[model samples]
Target: MKIAVMGAGAVGCYYGAMLARAGHSVTLVGRPQLVTAVQAHRLILEAAGRTEAVPVDATTDPSGVAGADAVLFCVKANDTLTAGRVIASHLGSSVPVLSLQNGVDSAEHLQAVLGRPVVPAAVYVAVDMPAPAHVRHHGRGELVIGPGPSSADIAEVFSRAGIPTEVSENVKGVLWAKLIVNCAYNALSAVAQLPYGQMMKTDSVPETMRDIVAECLAVAERSNVMVPGEVMSTVLGLAASMPDQLSSTAQDLAQGKESEIDHLNGYIVRAAARLGIAAPVNRALLVMVRLVEAKAQSARR
Candidate 1:
């Protein structure tokens, strides 16, 4: 399959490298720095104490997506509309685009912009870019892609590439489940600059997470999305499962990059407002993250 990965951040590079290694022709469209690094040394993928350079095409131009059979839209949630606009003219109407992003609304948002079908995918992986063109995988690399005309075939390709993929009719629910987890921890982790283990250990952290999850669950119920799993259990288990791992938002904040708070807790806040529901806990977290981001910006000046 001819694959194009838009964004080429840690998530993009990790999955793109996997597909490339599985012999799919993959082109990564990203920033010049990453494009240059990938062009020079392929993509360095580090996983399970092993590192391998996976060769794939890399470009800084959105036009790189033109001939792709499928495109993976992996940009941060806040970049969805901007990146969608950049690639809209270049993408074929028939090409299947998958939003392999954190937020639940990205695929729908991108689809609205592109006027084309887009599959929502729940990306289950812990990855980070330690350097340009390099992706370090902590663990778990799988995806649950929403049902679409091309979902089965895409899932097959990804599974063949050792990505552990599944095509799901309930991907939205899965996404909401994941979103709830993010709402519970991402802001707290970012505000504290702590990994999940330490963040969970802090006083009142568990209680706060529970409150966030409760608000998200209420919002999800009103939205008619059945968020799977016991929310509190999942929220608490993440810390044990990825003890030393920082929330992606925390990592982004630490790098002075914009965190996706607007999509996580902020999404819940908006949804609650629309449904005439109260989400004070979620709103508080969203506001706190925004304040932190604002403070970070001021520090830069």
Candidate 2:
């Protein structure tokens, strides 16, 4: 099967490389820097302390999505609408698009813009790009995608590429569960520039995280999404599971790029407001990250 990866950052490159390695034709659409790197040396995938350059088609143009049987829409949450329009302009109405992003609402947002079906995918992975077109896998890489017309076929293809994938009818809950975890840690880590272990050492930090989690859960309940797992336990266990790892928001701020706080905590605040529910803790965290992101953007200017 031919696959197209939009916004070919770490997540896109990692999965695209896997599919390419499995003998599927893969094309990565992204910025000029990543396109140049991939064109010159393929995609460098580093996992389990081993590195291999996996060859695949690379382009800076959105039109690279053409002829793809499926698309992994991995753009940042803020870019969903714009990227969706771009894809819709280039592709036919039949190709399946999957939002393999950080937020709960991207698939809905993209579907609205494209006027086409989109599958929401809950991704459990900790991978980062150490350099352009290079993916460094840090932890789990499993996906639970929402049911759609082509979801089963896509899941089968992804599984064949060594990516553990399943189609879940309850993917919204899974997405919320992941979002809650992000809400609990992402902004705090970004603001302090600390890893999970060190962040937990700060006075009252764990309690504050619990408060944030509770707010997010309340917001989730208002939205009627059954957040899976023991939410508090999962939030607290993150430090032990990935002690040295910084949140993606932290990494984005460190790199002078905009973080996805608006989609994490900010999304909670919006949902709470819409549902006539209050989420003060989530609101505060959202504001804090927004301030930091604004400061970073100003520094760049």
Who wins the TM-score comparison? 1
* Ten-residue stretch with the least lDDT total in model 2: 84-93
Residue 148's lDDT within candidate 1 is 88
lDDT (tens digit, per residue) of candidate 1 on 1-301:
9999999899999999999989999999999999889878989999889999999999999999999999999999999999999999998878999999988889999999999889999987888888999999987898999998888988888898999999878899999999998888888888888888988777898998888888888888888898777878988998998887788999998899999999999999998999999999988888988998899999999
Clash pairs detected, candidate 2? none
Candidate 1 Cα misplacement greater than 4 A, ranges: none
Superposition error at 204 for model 2 (Å): 2.4
Off by over 4 Å in 2: none
Write the residue-wise lDDT of candidate 2 on 50-119 in tens digits: 9999989999889999989999999999899888887788886699899999998899999899998899
lDDT of each: 0.90, 0.90
